[model samples]
Target: VPPGEFIPVAERFGIASRLDRWIIRTALSRHGAALRSGALTLGFNLSAQTLSDPQLWDFVDNVIEETGAPHSGIGFEITETAAVTNFDAAEQFVRKARERRCRVSLDDFGAGMSSFEYLRRFPVDTIKIDGSFIEHITQSRFDREIVLAITSIARSLGCDVVGEKIEQQDTLAMLSDMGVAFGQGFLLHRPEPLERIV
Candidate 1:
């Protein structure tokens, strides 16, 4: 199932945090050497329920310590919507995560009404533009404008911009021209099994 469909269900059922914990443990453990050596950086998308879980980082730090990945070379991707759900908690979470040397990213950035609010407050290192805007960016003037605006705002705030769902070469070129620091989609790499990736 697509994460958009299942994540909400997992969140409602209080299983999201457990799932997140499992992902963190598995990722750090399996990729410890590369992460510790700063050869690779792994990013995990966290659910809103997981963000509110007070024990989340302690668990993460323990796993990091056990793996001996100091930089952790791990970044947490929290959707803008999730960060807004519990503002204070989210703020504290971002601060603590960064303090521990893990990078934080605000995912699906323009999808939220309070995108600017989070940018002003949260010390996230990056903001990922919503895929909705990238889907037809090559054809839509409006999409291009929005992407430009987001990239400009993010740059002004000292946060890097990441463009998602970049499928075509035109889209990739456009995003690079617009100053997006990263791109992720089937165009760059199709999803592969963990065994193959590791």
Candidate 2:
């Protein structure tokens, strides 16, 4: 199942934590060796349920040690909605992860209600601009403005900004002009298996 569908179902059944563990374990088992060799960086999305569970951190720490994956090569992506749901816990997660040399990013940044507020609370390494805004960024002045504003704020806070759903060259060029640090979508590269890339 897609994460969007599975996450809600798992949360409703109070099994999100178990699902999270499986996801983390599977990801590590598949790519941990390559990650340790510095072949590529891996990013994992943690559900809000898992983020709020204090015990999750200990589990993650154990997995990292067991896999010998470099902390610096791992990135945890906390959605804007998730970060806002439990600000304190999310802050703790980000801080602890940073302490372990792991990167923390605020995913789907503009999709949430309080995007800017979360930025002030969480010291994330990157902000992924929501694709809704990027889809028509070139044609719509409002979308362009939103992207500009997000990029500007992120830059001032020393956070790298990434534009999502970049399927057009014009959009890519616009994002580059706006100083977006990264772009993700079909125009650049399609998503491929980690093993294939490694």
Candidate 3:
């Protein structure tokens, strides 16, 4: 990951999706092997370009079938900008995923096009509030207002809201007060190799 040079290398080989599949397969396999242990879910970030394909749904179904992973065990994270830009195409993907009980998150939510219109059109199970807003909540009334508003709105829609990049104790307390259902950040656990997940 030096200089982040390998990111494009992954995309160039069309291996992003392949890598995602591997992670899903491995996570699910591990979870099953440790049935006596608790359940585990895997999160995968898909490139916006990948959503352009109508067959993406079928490919996901195949992966679930091959890995014996429940649709609920998989989480697909989509950027708000990409989703709003290609709402039509993304809608179909989201709907099909939901129909199959898969979880969908509006990644980096509240960062771009905070349009109520987009929220109405998007079918998602979770909203990952942008860390920028979370980080500044103690210092900015505007940030607190936005966080409060988003939490209220998302909860009313039956969607869970997660505060990201919550590094401070007060931030976690405030987010809990605002009724955020989940959190993810270094304050919690940094992403590690998949082998150690289970």
| lDDT score, candidate 3 | 0.76
**lDDT measured at residue 124 in model 2 versus the true structure, 0 to 100:** 86
Error of 1 at 127 (Å): 1.0
Q: Model 1: clashing residue pairs?
A: none
* Better structure of 1 and 3 per lDDT: 1
- Model 2's TM-score against the true structure: 0.93
Each prediction's whole-model lDDT (CA): 0.87, 0.88, 0.76
RMSD of 3: 2.9
RMSD of 2: 1.5
lDDT tens digits, residue span 80-105, model 1: 77887788889999999888878899
lDDT of 2 by residue, 54-140 (tens): 898789889988888788988999997777778899999999998988999989988978888888888889999999999898899
Q: Please report how far candidate 2 places residue 61 from its true position, in Å.
A: 1.0
Note each model's CA RMSD in angstroms.
Answer: 1.5, 1.5, 2.9
Q: Which residue window of length 10 is worst by lDDT in model 1?
A: 189-198
**lDDT, residue 128, candidate 3:** 88
Best candidate, lDDT: 2
